[model samples]
Target: MYKHALAAAAAAAFIHLPSTAAEVVTQWNFNSLPADGATGTGTTAAAIGSGTASLVGGATASFASGDASGGSSDPASGDDSGWNLTTFAAQGTGSGTRGAQFAVSTAGFENLVISFDLRHSNTSARHELLQISLDGISFSDFALFDADAGGDRWYTGRTVDLSAVAGASDNASFAFRVVSAFAPTTGQYAATGVGSSYGTSGTWRMDMVTLSGTAIAPVPEPGAMALLLAGLGVIGTVVRRRA
Candidate 1:
């Protein structure tokens, strides 16, 4: 009875253990504003982020905003192609820049969840995309194009849903990211000057980019089934010995 009781507890602790949803390994904010707004705390800045226009050559992205004076990050003049590192920025919120992008490194992730806030300060700030990947080599697309990319303008807080991208997988190690860019570059707007960048006169901002989730390789459960199998093997050996 005592042995069985101990086994029960062991099984409960391991198999039924409470799970903690994975959370941010790291995060950043470009809102360089001081923890407390005070005089001489550094003003005249964009109070948002490094709104520079470039490609994701290969560099890590920070969600929190900071002083633009030394704010911008690397992969600077190049593009964002390297793995693991990524960038999320759309051109002019209300002005002549319209774009967005999603990227990720599949090597370090399997099952994961990524969340972030965005400011569609203008017409060109909307995006309808969420990128999901497993093994970084295989990826799935979650297109939100049917809905307004950035949602209603003047709207400052919005999150991209990755379920569409993940599709169907009980659990898999993976990373989820976003992709957006200045579109409407052609068509009637091509000659008429109606491209997305030319839509209005503003810019957008991203805050709180977080990646959290567990690598989802199946783990064997230590339970009665396992113990029973072991016992059955032992019994079979004994019968063979007797024979």
Candidate 2:
């Protein structure tokens, strides 16, 4: 009976092994840290962790209000800013070519997830594609989003689950992009707003861009290992005496 109890306790310890919780690896809030009280002024540097944010395919970027057009998901009450992008490809040209890109190393992490808030202008492309790159050079489409709602509205919580992409975890070159794309089954881009035409001058405002993952637990230290071995030895001695 004592031997059985000891075996049961060992099994319980393995069964209850602690799990790592998901946490934000990197985040781009875009709002100034000191609250400058000006919506037109903000920083592109990540507000949490380290990463790089850049425009892609000749797009121009500026700071814009995250609170405009019904506001974004940002919790900031005042001086909230978002990364605004424009100079998209000409109508019916360069689909999935113009937008923003972000690079963040996922070293020592797994089960990656990406999320953000976006606001579409009236004449912006209705379809947007989320692309991922393991090598940070070539990208592949992972998901597509449609701003079906009328323009000047915030589309919060645009998320992509990359847990199944094994190469995305523990990778130093992981990167992603959100770009305008042609409407599904159509060769041309559709307007975000009804009764409007797609145009290159339209803007996309992004806020609360974040990457998250579960941290890989570190190996036990030498002292911890020694203690564990000593405990196991004690247990074996106890078991032998009981026998």
Candidate 3:
């Protein structure tokens, strides 16, 4: 079976759950303030995807701040750089291009499944890459699968997966890194709109992002629970007096 075959099927079914807690985990999508280096800001109120990077791909990455239903747009500038998105242009047009997005430690989500959805037609290259990371600082490439080519054109879509990053429990963070790594003159890379500064941009466009993961279960770092109980009692007295 195609590596993404399951993802596409799973993608359809995964959106409705609470997404707050689960073994699979995912970005419920937040559409407000931008996640630093993304395309838009917090006011947007749109969810980009799970993981630190924008589920979408680009040069200046795109990220939303809300969930699946309500979200805003995330733009890609230069300043923000943790888990970001960038683009690969061709000739003068960005049509024949590739969208590159990633997961960052700062955005949230720790060790879990992470995947990217892509639409490829006549890919010049065989292996397209979608990977993950533990610290927004370091990176690790995970999967290699062929981009599905429908014709000599590109389409739009999303990507999701379970990641293989390390130290997830301790850091409580991870990142998704995307690169138009294999720069072939023609093929999926080209068809999807990612060519050199001079090649005929192929055709890659991506929209929609999400991040879903069961945050590292609250272990309550040593005795924190005891302190929590004490704090609650104090608040309880205040409520009684107000009543």
Candidate 4:
């Protein structure tokens, strides 16, 4: 009886084990490999995993220094670059319409989370909106970031948690965007700096874009299932004999 109880307890413990630990599903450091010594040169390809990074809403992209304006969260010593984006809509136009987008497959993962480092120019939009899409077509707003501290400085570790969105988990068409948004109440764009005016030429630099989640546990193999069933049978036989 004691052995049967022990076996039962062990099975229960194994069955109730927690989900797998969170892992980086995709990441883009935007830094050049091999220390190219040129901050103006980098790749948009994901540094850690497979994904696509693209400009959205008429925004143009170029590589810029990640070590400028007190630097980003990147630890690379040389050739650390960030994606510099510009060509925003003119003042009082295209609210929430211009910026960058990244698409990644989130299959077999759950509890989605996204993070990035961004630098807003003094003349850039003060309000930035984060949007997500499960179908890769229609997007819904998820979070809004205010660069109230002014621009020409780094804002590291901007994060959005999507653990509550059931469709975000294990989806093949997961995508997200960060776009310039109108001010909360005014319905007009505001400049990042205290006295600066919003402009189409202002830039937004982005680095360390990352997506993470917990991997879904795999189903038990046939051999493992057979072993478990055999163990249960032995435990049942022992209990019956003792009774």
Report the number of backbone clashes for model 1.
Answer: 53
Task: In model 3, state the lDDT of residue 45.
Answer: 31
TM-score of every model? 0.42, 0.87, 0.43, 0.87
What digit string (tens of lDDT, one per residue) describes model 1 on residues 51-149?
122223132332323222122231112121111113233233321212333333333233445555544433333443455555533545543332243
lDDT-superior candidate, 3 or 4: 4
Candidate 2's C-alpha runs over 4 A off are 1-19, 219-230, 235-243
lDDT for residue 167 in candidate 4, whole number 0-100:
95
RMSD of 3: 15.5
Mind giving the per-residue lDDT tens digits that candidate 4 earns over 107-127? 989989999999999998988
**In every candidate, how many clashes are there?**
53, 0, 93, 0
Off by over 4 Å in 4: 1-19, 221-226, 232-243
Score candidate 3 by TM-score against the native.
0.43
Ten-residue region with minimum lDDT total, candidate 1: 75-84
Q: Which window of 10 residues has the lowest lDDT sum in candidate 2?
A: 10-19
lDDT of each: 0.36, 0.92, 0.40, 0.90
Candidate 2 local Cα displacement, residue 234, angstroms: 1.6
